[model samples]
Target: MSDEVKVSDAEALRFHAEGRPGKLAIAPTKPLDTARDLSLAYSPGVAAPCLEIFRDPNLVFDYTSRGNLVAIVSNGTAVLGLGNLGALGAKPVMEGK
Candidate 1:
């Protein structure tokens, strides 16, 4: 792994501000555009998998996003600015990630 240093507050802030919201996005890897796709994704066809999941709850991991998502939480009590704390204080750090 390479060592990358955070140079200046302004540079850091610029990157954060440019992406104001966050650093990652989630999108479906498969396409669902036709009637068959609709059926397979949401209706009768979907129910087949849903029933399988219902029979074995652990199957949710194989069919849904729950298996791959991550939640990063913090209280922000010790951020760079003593004046900032809580969710608002941690927003920049979270977005930078």
Candidate 2:
């Protein structure tokens, strides 16, 4: 196998710095065009699902993004090439990934 990197370190840095800093962002799946939409997305309408999830924890997957999203958590203790760099050092590396 080849251990070649397609992008240079400087190029990668520029790509991230030129944009909105990080690669991830949050966006609403539904439209919030009116007070009713706001209430449903935030207050009274939200309570129904909250109550359901409270009764059955597994329901969180069905009602929320938890089912579709996977959180990548690490302390950088085993970073590639650089081992045991700790959480603070691992943050930038993890975010870049």
Candidate whose lDDT is highest: 2
Query: Compared with the true structure, what per-residue lDDT tens digits does model 2 show for residues 1-97?
Result: 8998699889988987786876777888788999999999889899999999999999999889896676789978998889999997677677767
Candidate 1 regions with alpha-carbon error over 4 angstroms:
1-4, 19-21, 78-84, 95-97
Q: What value does the lDDT take at residue 86 in candidate 2?
A: 95
Find the 10 residues in a row with the least total lDDT in model 1: 15-24
The lDDT, on a scale of 0 to 1, for candidate 2 is 0.85
- Model 2, position 48, has a per-residue lDDT of 98
TM-score of each: 0.65, 0.72
lDDT for residue 57 in candidate 2, whole number 0-100: 99
Question: In order, what is each prediction's RMSD in angstroms?
Answer: 3.9, 2.5
Q: Choose the strongest candidate by TM-score.
A: 2
RMSD of 2: 2.5
